[model samples]
Target: MRGAKSAKWVVGAVIVALAATACGGDNKDDKPTGAGKAGGTFSLGLVEPVSIDPVNAQESEGILVTDNLFTGLYEPTADGKVIPALATSKTVSDDGKTWTFKIKPGTKFTNGEIVNAEAFIRGWTRLAAKASASDVATPNVGGIDGFEALQKGTATTFSGLTAPDENTLQVKLTTPDFEFDVKTTHTSMSPVPKVAGAGKNQAYNDAPIGNGPFKMSGKWEHNKSITLVRNDDYGLTKAHLDTVKISILNSANAAQLEYQGFQSGQFDWARMPTAQLTSAKAKYTAQNEWIQADTSGMNYLLPITENGPLKTAKARQAISYAIDRDAIIAGVFQGMQTKSTTILPPSFKDVYQKDLCVSCIKQDKDKAKSLAAEAGLKPGDELHIGFNTGGGHEEWVQAVVQQIKDVLGLNVKMDAKPFKELLAAQQAPGATGAYRFAWGADYPTPDNFLFPLLDSKSINKDASGKVQGDNRGRYNNPAFDALVEKARSTKDSAARNEVYKQAEKLAMDDQALIPLWNRTQFRLVNTKKFTGGAMDFHEDPNLAEISAK
Candidate 1:
């Protein structure tokens, strides 16, 4: 696949915190049958999702809801493969610029509308339309031919798309992107009504239509709960659970509360909050039911570029080399996560190349001080660090501050801003000092992991050319960018891996970002009642595969 050309990125936020756990067996009027049985109910905990609209929702909190509510053209397997879902089969043309898909027979949305090629075409067209206002969505879909023009209002419709008949969908691309299947994992192709309504319809956002195994039973109650019932006509895999309830507990201590709720038998699945990990580990370990997997996103740090010492890569490397990742893991995360050296998560065993980051694997106070001095930094320099509004950042803030002070003799000032304000501040020219970076998979490919967030092409500019895209720090290097572009355009798996490894080394050598740790999902399922719940590498829980034990 010709890979990501996306300098412009789209909708989504990484899931930041873990869930809470509690203990007890609460009474219920009905008990579900064992795993593999035909019917039962399952409940899980969540922080509030921003939107249930498949095209608009970006964060994982919203994905959990949307994944259940709709099925995309392709389904991601737990191991990182993209296979057909709504699509019966897909084939690429000789030139690799066109793709044709065969829709599964008899697929229909909850509204009883046929999920034909036109349905798919309309969904894609609407997503790229000028009025969608889908900041989180437009970037992902705009890579298609003419979609970008449609979003820019230069074109009324995407000329790249055509549905010659009811069942066949054809797509023409401007470039040869072999990894296009990976992009299909996003829900931008979830077929909509023949005549879609205008922006943000309250009725449409809630109780939305889908062709997935489950259907929304009622309107989504923001920061409260969303209820779902099974679609008996779902054409693919059988939906073992009769119902699913997602409780949105937007409390300051939501993670801790989920701990208590799940232990009380209120939640069928929940995360073991880091706050209670120490206390719950012994008991949960004894039950032999706790699940732990490295959710394939990254927890890293970025340094802003416009004016400061960070403009010099040496200063950034000095900062990266001085930090103590172990202390953060021991103090803040309780030693559950694996150390990260690059943006690629350790879970992609074959794709991630070890030993790619130079002078970053271990803390070296002497080397850090030397590098800082070379970058023109003297003692008592006040370093400004920015973070989004939240409670859990205090310990991390304190740790990084103390580390910098001890190693480089620098003073640290922390800036806390609301989420919206933080995003704006980060994008402003030469203003954002330093901030954190967390990226969950928008797709399963390594290119999806490396591009947009780190590429030079993603750097936005005005008429005057000040950097703006998500590469907030403006870390631009020609050699690095070439390697990345080569990796994106290559088709052979071995060639892709070879080029990616080179790009990974080049990126970290420049200290594109200081990789801190791999995300670990502290998963807990009610073993007595629920027996099958698995998360794909993207961390989407497969609802169709879930069942009551």
Candidate 2:
């Protein structure tokens, strides 16, 4: 769900430009399978992942690696449907609080362990436990009964989870949710093999044994690369490619380097740096090898509300009103990015509302100056903006800093740190006033965009009051929270979406976060060397379907 954290965020590109592109695979044989020439390495570029272990892998880089290494009970399709993968059938109770899943029998992890109901139980239980240090556990599975107990370390397992037999998993939730199956598609919910051992095991993180179409060929070479070979014993749709090779590039010029690698034949699929996008598209588009897609990711600025100059909504709105998104998108991103008018991305067309945030309009220097004056902020007041380096954010951040200075007559400071360090700073007590934020939907639902990222319950505070979780800005509105809850408990889809729209409106009215632009995935592929390589609904490469040309 963490998008920009991907290595230069290369591996997270989606596809909307090429309608004729073969993404999933060609099932021309009229059979439920993916088959093709099967013996060659398919190489691509990647940034070093934070962690590949299912419990801790939340960023796009780590999640991309995990997707190839493990197939969950369900897989997200290009059409935004959660289709059965490891599980065959699911049934729900009338109250909608109880659900049962029938796992595919005899499915084996690469290490020869059975991926049964107990494996899913153990994996989810570990993810929910605070000792596991999983970032996804609470946001994705907090609806399960006793989740709070696990977070407090008072329970070792989820009280709502039960394995009726080797193949059956029964779950009880504290509240009704129709999209529980969709949430299971997340990497953290993937079944962990028994060999993984317990409690954030490092060995397993290095080389995980998985039950997918591919398995790790060897231990992950940190800051280097990772290679995966086809899982010969995999039970479902077989893979067309024999191996997947991912090169890890984390230098400040990673985007430039990745583009160069693609040109030199070092990569079959590569992300185009914004600087080279114009020329790359001009050349590759003619060859039908260019890809520009609308991603579910959104880039924003979180104005820390707990303390600092941005404590008031007026100050935050002033900041939002000052920046020129169209100018930045055209000047810096080479017209490759779209200016965002709302918190929701373009992919959520049905539920998305135009100009949902009144403060989200284009740059209005007069408005910004007036709002800042009302908030008692003026010239010479130091405004700090925090961001991470090596993620293609510096140029835009500088542009934003300059705009704020010219419009509001404020002295702005740019605090840049490494990605991981920036994340630590965001969670610490009295964090930065404003920081860069990027998120991809964990699932294709309005709740996926709202609840975990904005809801009050998503924020976790320790004894000393250090805040953690996705609500990094610490913005809380009971009215917004109430609307989100109403939406979640609603069984009807149309009614649920209506409530979500209201919640978004309330949050935006408070200027919860400064919406910059919806993310656009840019890539150049060597069609001569690869086929069936395309981005799926999750904005992930469909590795299993790709084959060497």
Candidate 3:
């Protein structure tokens, strides 16, 4: 969940919740029944991989593939914890500016290259190279001492990084970031063998070598499928499944096709389409093969430009209070997902400050109309709403459009574009006044949610001079930014969380963006064939952890 990756808009941006709140140790109810029989090909239906190159991959589909293919220093747990992966343990200096990682002994990449500090150095060197231009790694990599030099082609290695031995790696950051370790969990830090390394090279993107439980068995078929075989030489307890077949059924009816495959035993698992949820539940009511997860992410509607009718904070607040989150959940998601009252999920319940948007979530149409009138908007006025296609957003977007019309009496005329074109449009100057959006955490920290999407410093001007960040909304508040900056600089966890609460409250007061329901995922799995696999928010049960029953 780290790196500067932002490609999640194609799928849904998965902003992981802050550590100790929404992370790790969340799956206590699922008991481990010893690894079942090995040697079975687990079939999964997924969209085509955007890029198999771990460093360049940013979307959920690519992450799903690489999570099993590559290993990083840390990995996310179901309960929202960042636990050690490649490293035995990580230690921080008293100053909190330096970190020391104790590497696991005898780990090796799929290509037989020894996994060591130099491996990481080489991997990062490639990513930092000017020619590589790794959009996903640029931001956090800049946190390192010599990263600027590396990016500018003046240095061959990070000055902050040192390896006294193969087993020891030390890094010095430009600033003190206690939650920095969680950033290492991203695939950007996954060590790649020099021979198999390629940032945008088609060869490497086609079949990248990995150090995880599985390795690419063959070339990635264009818009079709990819196969992964067990990595026998992996250091950890080996993967149970002998192979994994990831098929790309890109039909507009892909979900239904996959579900049909599951019904016909052609596929072992599939995600239930939202459109078919009601019927699917009825058809499979007695079957206990349902796998559901409350993924760590939130959805909100953004006002991409400030020059339109939604320019006023009151107009924005009206929209925020206007969304009937409960009705939206029931109408759009069939009640599979729950309404999100806070930007931060309940995973961080202690600090989420659910009371912040109590009135907004109350669905009081009168308050919304009053807020609208304050913005000089009247009943029957047209409100422009924009969104991107793909990722099954149509059905839900339509439902949301209808909700605004029925509740607020506003004419919600939506401009829908393909994901890429929509992003481009959103970034264009004088573009959208209202845009549907979502954000997933780059790291498991409140800073990921607050700073990137809110802090003015993160904002940048596009070609058309339109300001953008993940904030896309162009929502800015100096007070909120100050609170967020304080939260970032503070090392005390309690103080930081409290600061975040205040910051979140300030943002809620502005009501620049409307919070929608936090989406849930439901995948149908063959229970008898897979015994120990447990699904979670970010991704499904790890392929390594799944076994034939």
Candidate 4:
């Protein structure tokens, strides 16, 4: 999932402090710049790239930029319900195998290309075509009928998809999927102009043509910074902002920027630095709004290689038992985390299993040592671990390595590499050993958590012919896979939950991956400058409703 998970809640906590600091402004008049202004510019500092292309993007920062510059057929509501965006309404067959959508009228791309039935066909077909090399397309559309066949080069046509008119599009599925609407909100479903850019993937990166409220003005240094000007041709007049500027700011310097007021009144909103939460609260007292919500995301220490000393199930369980997750939360996050018992967070009320705790791998140094010995590991076995300094809980990573070294009596080496390099290494097949990374919900479903992270088949050869991205660990268990598949195919929610519960138990017992904690979503917006309800899914500052005080 491309949403912020761990940092969202922490950011929300800081927002609360910001809200306390700044008070008494009506929510309506909190926008930093008055609506309809054309000259002033608002700058946003992001921890990652503000990439224009949706295919190669991975983080929420990039998605935020996409959301502002792109429009999809559907979007998710605050309650996790799907609502129309480019499409007016959709109808599903009683058996749930067929879906038909009525496209919204009078929509036009920024290039003045009138959106029609052909546009929908062209966009989806392009995404479905492996020749496009679209990363977002393959995963999101793989569930549709003939999609897999198309990707495998056995099919020339997408059997599941059809567009009969400029205003209507239809999809025929092989089986019933209850989460179809939720899936449609993904970026893969976003419409793009057919002749907007050249070269397969270069077009989206260089110039994006979407029927959104904003149009890409320019991109600098391959998405380090991006510029977007208001799409004056847009049909919606409610979008008050004239332009938006996004700048890439490393997490380390985010605090300094916020503390220095570089973004305070000049820009409407910016991520509050973790170290400045308290001080920001005191400084912006009564002029800010901070909110926190469970993001349904998990951060874990994943073991990459399922061979060697850590390959045995018992050995993995022992390693899990040795680390103190509570200490990591307190010391690293400053009490900003909830201990996770399972892969799915409690926010997913229906599918999150509360009863199953088969391998409640709590802190037990002695037990871990015994299990390691049982796996035939000598006292001097070398265990190598790695993490990324580019994103997430650096302190936690250091503390985990220390705990493993001290408790296991093993020689341990830890490598903290750059974020991008670490991501590349993690995606490389046959890479022995695991690293720490945060998993955010792509959608608000337990299937999102289990299928992508644990499924054996999710691994695939990237452009370089190396197995990459999800399923990097290459950990596989037939029992676990069966349970997940059963859960997916079964329509009965209760039955699916039961199967998922079993899957969770098996994952825990086998120690497939260590469950760290469910992260909280956090946003600190200066209420004096901007006002709107915060979103748990993404930081979507609704500009239409905001005004300058």
Stretches > 4 Å off in candidate 3: 1-34, 125-130, 133-135, 138-142, 148-156, 196-198, 282-285, 305-309, 376-390, 406-411, 415-431, 440-443, 457-469, 476-478
Q: In terms of TM-score, how similar is model 4 to the real structure?
A: 0.85
Error of 4 at 286 (Å): 4.8
**Candidate order (lDDT):** 2, 3, 1, 4
Candidate 1 C-alpha lDDT tens digits along 480-514: 77877677567776888888888777778777777
Query: Which segments of model 1 are wrong by more than 4 Å?
Result: 1-35, 136-139, 195-202, 306-309, 376-394, 415-431, 456-481
Scored by Cα lDDT, where does model 1 land? 0.67
lDDT of model 2 at position 499? 86
**What's the true lDDT of residue 331 in model 1?**
83
TM per candidate comes to 0.85, 0.93, 0.85, 0.85
Best-performing candidate as measured by lDDT:
2
RMSD of each: 6.7, 3.2, 5.5, 5.2
lDDT of 2 by residue, 180-267 (tens): 8778878788898887766568888899888877899889998899999887777776677788889988776667777888888888
Model 2 worst lDDT run, 10 consecutive residues: 19-28
Q: Write the per-residue lDDT of candidate 4 for residues 459-494, one digit (tens) a residue.
A: 655657565336666678888878777776666778
Model 4 off-target regions past 4 Å? 2-40, 153-157, 196-199, 235-237, 250-268, 272-286, 305-309, 355-361, 462-465, 539-547
**What's the lDDT of the predicted structure labeled candidate 3?**
0.68
- The C-alpha lDDT values of all candidates are 0.67, 0.78, 0.68, 0.61
Clashes (N, CA, C under 3 Å) per candidate: 18, 1, 14, 33
Segments in model 2 whose C-alpha atoms lie over 4 Å from true places: 5-35, 463-466
In model 4, the Cα lDDT at residue 58 comes to 51
